[model samples]
Target chain A: MYKHTTDGLRTLLNIPDNYQIFFLSSATEIWERIIQNCVEHTSFHCVNGSFSKRFYEFSGELGKKAFKEEAAFGKGFYPEKFEIPAETEAICLTQNETSSGVSMPVADINKIREKNKEALLFVDAVSSLPYPEFDFTKIDSTFFSVQKCFGLPAGLGVWILNDRVIEKAKQLEAKKVLTGTYHTISSILSKAKDNQTPETPNVWNIFLLGKVIEDMNKKGIATIRKETEVKADMLYNYIKDSNNFSFGVEDPAHRSKTTIVANTAIPAPEVNKKLEQFDLAVGSGYSSYKEKQIRIANFPAYSVEKTEELVNALKKTIG
Target chain B: MYKHTTDGLRTLLNIPDNYQIFFLSSATEIWERIIQNCVEHTSFHCVNGSFSKRFYEFSGELGKKAFKEEAAFGKGFYPEKFEIPAETEAICLTQNETSSGVSMPVADINKIREKNKEALLFVDAVSSLPYPEFDFTKIDSTFFSVQKCFGLPAGLGVWILNDRVIEKAKQLEAKKVLTGTYHTISSILSKAKDNQTPETPNVWNIFLLGKVIEDMNKKGIATIRKETEVKADMLYNYIKDSNNFSFGVEDPAHRSKTTIVANTAIPAPEVNKKLEQFDLAVGSGYSSYKEKQIRIANFPAYSVEKTEELVNALKKTIG
Candidate 1:
């Protein structure tokens, strides 16, 4: 079966050819590949979650300069502050930060693009692609994992690049030191355009992904996104009303439409241990907030019933 | 089903911790990732196959210094006249070149290692692991694909690494730029050691690989290797007596015992196309030699009768 990950992103992002597109096996790989290859130019990272911090660290590793506009986990990126460096070749942003459960608004993306006309825009939509309102047209390269939005197996990353990215890759290919292999933009372009792969491709995952896309198309991304919003609202409402539970992010506007990050009266690890006993798994706080906060994902496959179960579990565990 | 792949090269080579390990979904990914990441280091391509040349091209694209010691296809990498660069930091060698049907001798590898202790050794043993005489002691990093020898459905790569390689990754991590994500050495090391993966791994493939390995252990790698050797000999002897066909690589010592590369008086593509009519699919020559050679694989699963059937088909098509 043919999987249209890149095509899906292209349609979503409306990417142009002037951009430089690349794919790594994971969102983390994207950060690393960019830092290693795009050393000649500066990158602007719109920070919110661990992934954004990873980009910041990646830039430091490459000894390149990057500008960061930080926001709390639930807060969206500040487009006005994402000033493209004079030598900036790329502007990096995450469409939806999974860990923080926050998403950058389309208006914010447009404003950033308006400010940085010469700079190529790259976005990590790993967690945001499934939502109906995600505007792909403003970004040069947008990437996600099939496992997240498509509900397929992980291992394959879905990336879409416009003609500009393709041209950059071609130029790089001509220079002869294109450093990407299995996930190289050139190789992926070559194979994907032809509905083939450079080496033995991931057959099973791609097959399932194709099926997932077909199923989603039939169900409509809009309907799915609406359902996700409803689920998020239900959980958020419960958490907000509960005196014993509080949100990690103070701003309601920054709240995630998919994953809800909440702080409980009880210690996070203790709550996590209790949740595990009930066979429920929720994400723990990473980095600075470790053992302090809990993240609940309301992805497509996660039903209202599951959310109810989690809410009840949280109530019982907290009590 | 824990499948093994060329990714296993990381452990087989016992790469030092100070060197970074990057995984592209396929060995092809390695070529591109290297080009993107290792611009400062020169690469020495020692193996004789399509993959080695591809690596050479990748290095050339980067304007990075690269040298290839071309062995005739189906012949192993020979140490003769294989000069190591004074500043060589990496050597790309295929433990078993599947397309060429050749396996490099360990002695050649020893010579290379002795000559360039500072250079990281990279091997593609996609077709030669867990079999008898497959040693992983000297190299720094090695890789393999699951489909060829691991007896699992394709999609996953089983990569192993030593402490030294992990340390090198730490340095990369310190730099905060890693070339891989899901395929990263550090991620794979932590998860794989526990028989798990960082991303949603190819669970089915892993299960199949584990089963295959268990069966191999039960039967013994030595016994399996011996049987494979016998199988290759049987097919080779049959080809030797046939006037209509000839081996692609002239030297018997360098020819792979797993895959048999044969050249027919007729164009290889025509021969392969004709053979497919009988439900027998053979690999056609890759790249430059597309119509020149046909590769018949003698995996452990192929019995003596199957080998005979293939020989008869060859005779019927060309003789």
Candidate 2:
């Protein structure tokens, strides 16, 4: 399962041979490990919405000197200047903000690297993986939980980091800094060389992920990504043309292609109740926007036909 | 699933309302979280075997002043004096040493309580839960992974800690110590109060755990414990009487009723191969004892008839 899944993921995601993939319990745990293993004291975060802000909070809780540049909610982060401290060890960027339905283009990663060549560039591609068309070589690492884009059950988080991350971890361990307990990069990498995890991992999920990826490989990632784009476009066009709702992200270019959140004239809960009458359900706005926004997921599993049905349901509910 | 499982677990394990259960990925992760959240600077570990020693190592990696008193492998720890440091914030004890099959009696918990009045008492009941007849009130916390006594698949660890543990974590937080990252005790408790987890947990396993606990509740833990004892007695008596094998633990009182490890004159691999002819499989000895010992699990799920079959297979293999 390990060899097959690693191979499948590499082929599906266009991951390079230099990059290494390790599976953890969740993307949240990856945030903890990233700070512990890669960052020594300070790291810079570009926060567009909730998940990016949560990563900043995680670094702070781990006793790191966490600095952040924040964009307004429901907006994308555009770095005018990489005005980060020279001693910063890493820079965190969110490719797709699930909470606010905004995404930063892959070009933003190159810009960060242009300013700071040494600091590791980390991306939270939680809701955008396999569909983002990311230039993986530009970033040092990226992570995602399976429940989002893969349409699998939660419990497994896939973390892809390069050899530079390993070097940084070894440097910290040599200097007697606390990387972590068992799941530290040095410990995991040592065991991973044997195609194994550090502890008794979620083996069942790993097996299932392998099977899913095998199926995805048969269908071809290009076909999957194209279908996802069409479904996302259909849903987005409906919301844009509707008078009763408006897109959450003001710029069409900045709006997330995976998770589409919209501001509705009716209360979000009320709109959800109307959709429920059609045997359709969608998530309410994240956190504070719960009352005013509705979130729709255009994942790979959501077929073009099903998405069109959902669009029709939304139009009838709004009317 | 949380409410049903919590209720069913409380009934099956005789847990009081004050003892809270938070689920993590594995027992290894629990060791990391326990030391991070419950211990501030110093802690005492009573190490009998490999698993207990691992817990002590975890504390050290997290930068705690970890002190340890060790017993020989396959021997139980008996504290003659409470020689632990006064500043120690937590005391770690392993209820059953899974690697060596030595268990500390429940009565010994009172002896430590008598010495240390304020420190949090944490127990690793990884292979001896819902059948150990533990007086939960005597210890502040105990944790177990479902793959052991619960007879479920791996990946879910249930931690039962009381308010005292929570208070200790809050004190560490107030002092600006790193309690942990996202799954810290305080963060988990805050979410558990709302019957939730901090992140997308392994929801399928949680659902299965609830169903398994409901079945156990119906079977009654007492009946299950009785069967386990019977199985352990059968296996232990066979080892003692057979010329080819002997009990691993020196004293019968210290022998674990859940996992029975026996020293064998024949190489353990040969014994396993012989048993395989009967279509029976047993675990190889852990770590260094791999070739010299055979470990048998006396979990509740191994019914009386199944244990009898295994015993008969062992008799034939020895003959």
User: What local distance difference test score does each model get?
Assistant: 0.65, 0.87
lDDT of 1 by residue, A1-319 (tens): 5536445433434345443333335556566655444434467788888777777766754556777778766577666654556787668888777776677776777788878777778777787666736444566666777677667656666555667555655655566544454445665666765677667766777767666766666676667788888888888887888776688666676676766788767667777788887898777766566677777767788877788888788778764
Could you tell me the TM-score of candidate 1? 0.83
State how far residue A151 of model 1 sits from its true place (Å). 2.1
DockQ of each: 0.40, 0.78
Query: In model 2, what is the error at residue A165, expressed in angstroms?
Result: 0.8
Best by DockQ: 2
CAPRI verdict (incorrect, acceptable, medium, high) for model 2: medium
Cα RMSD (angstroms) for every candidate in the order listed: 4.6, 1.6
- Name the runs in model 2 displaced over 4 angstroms: none
For B1-319, candidate 1 gives per-residue lDDT tens digits of 3325322432433344433333335656555544434335577887477777777877765556887777766666557666877777667787677767777776777777877777667766677664425344567666666688666656655444445545555565566553444445555567655555555545555556556666666666667778888878877887788786787777787777887877767777788777886777667776666677777777877777777777778778766
Q: Scoring only chain A, what TM-score does candidate 2 earn?
A: 0.97
Summing lDDT over every window of 10 consecutive residues in candidate 2 chain B, give the lowest-scoring window: B77-86
